[model samples]
Target: MLLRKLVPVFALSLASAGVSADRLKPEDAVEYRQSAFRLMSFQLGVLNPLHRRQAYDDEAFVYRAETLSRLAELALEGFTEDSKGQQSRTQARMWDEREAFETRLREFAETTAQMAERSAAGDSRATRDLFRQTLQSCKSCHDRYRIE
Candidate 1:
């Protein structure tokens, strides 16, 4: 709900700011992607307690899930050919096996979006299951494509 409204505003702000993805240097793209992932990691911190049933904040969880979903959508845009050789945890195989790598990213995006929807619907069980799938997606990609 809030995310839906905020997204257009965010896009308009970025556009007005003249933030051109294509104009970014390779290292800039690497930094951009890493920053998104770092935020995603921060958002994921809520999952452990929620999964354990020790804590549950519906509003916060929904917001974080939606934010994570949006970040997943943006993350892959940073994997440009120009960014391939930048110093990062990204592996050469991400480029060598671009199709497979991208497929994994899409999977992550899908899982996150589903989790967000479930969270918004107040379905804790489904949200928790989807969250685990989201974590597995991250682990899968990291195992296959990240250096460490």
Candidate 2:
């Protein structure tokens, strides 16, 4: 009887844990842009901590890089759709810039993945260079597409 009671309690806790792990999706353009921005912030938060000499992990570095890349791509994606609002900062020209933005994001992701591989192989210099390149891409996209 005690075992059966414990099983249900354990299963309920596990189910709740999974629900808590689920991320909330943004429902509008403004919220989507802000979500993208927050994702980039999170990537930046993880980068230095995961990439430093004493704190490096190839898997973690790759994960953060991939996350940053996805956020950049999503930022552009949010702009491509019509934002049914009068106060959107998304320029009409963003549709034209979409392809280029996607290319840059892909390149950034690939470079960072390479950096992770190099880090795994113990190449510190390559890792640093790749990290800089990744940051540059983020800045370039934000400069062109995002408005305060």
Candidate 3:
């Protein structure tokens, strides 16, 4: 989790593992937030079909869940700035209701982390249930705090 602490610092200079070369403007911050979520979605998305089809092996599920957990960590960091610009769906309440937003964000992150642990333990049922719980938190937060 040392990486987590370093992300916001690197974000100011806007550099990480070949991610960005230029300094981050507020608009760039907005893009970073969106891109982080998109990547999180993609990680979950790949496993979704396997979930429905019940076709994936235990290793795949664990790997994806672990990846999802890491991505969730990255996601919280993206919201460090009050980034507002065209195409940003972030509501003012993200900054205004910072405590509430962070409360839910932490809950979501913890849920994903739990999923990773359960998946790694070979508990597919618990992992899948945790995935639903995680998704629900995502929806609930977006419903109240995101712009359509």
| Top lDDT prediction, candidate number | 1
Per-residue lDDT for 111 in model 3? 79
Report, for every candidate in turn, its global Cα lDDT versus the true structure: 0.75, 0.60, 0.69
Q: Candidate order by lDDT, highest to lowest?
A: 1, 3, 2
Q: Which stretches of candidate 3 lie over 4 Å from their true place?
A: 1-24, 55-57, 82-87
* Cα error of candidate 3 at position 126, Å: 1.4
Off by over 4 Å in 2: 1-30, 49-59, 73-76, 84-92
Q: Write the per-residue lDDT of candidate 1 for residues 14-54, one digit (tens) a residue.
A: 33566567977899889888888888888888766666772
Point to the candidate with the largest TM-score: 1
Q: Which of candidates 1 and 3 reaches a greater lDDT?
A: 1
TM-score of 1: 0.81
TM-score of each: 0.81, 0.59, 0.74
Per-residue lDDT over 64-106 for candidate 2, one digit per residue giving the tens place of the 0 to 100 score: 7656655654554444344434356555455577767657655
Report the C-alpha displacement of residue 112, candidate 3, in angstroms. Answer: 1.0
Q: Model 1 lDDT vs. the true structure?
A: 0.75
Candidate 3: tens digits of C-alpha lDDT, residues 21-120: 2356667666776887898888778778767866334566766766676666566656654354445687877777877887787677677777867876
Lowest lDDT block of 10, candidate 3: 6-15
Preferred candidate (TM-score higher): 1 or 3: 1
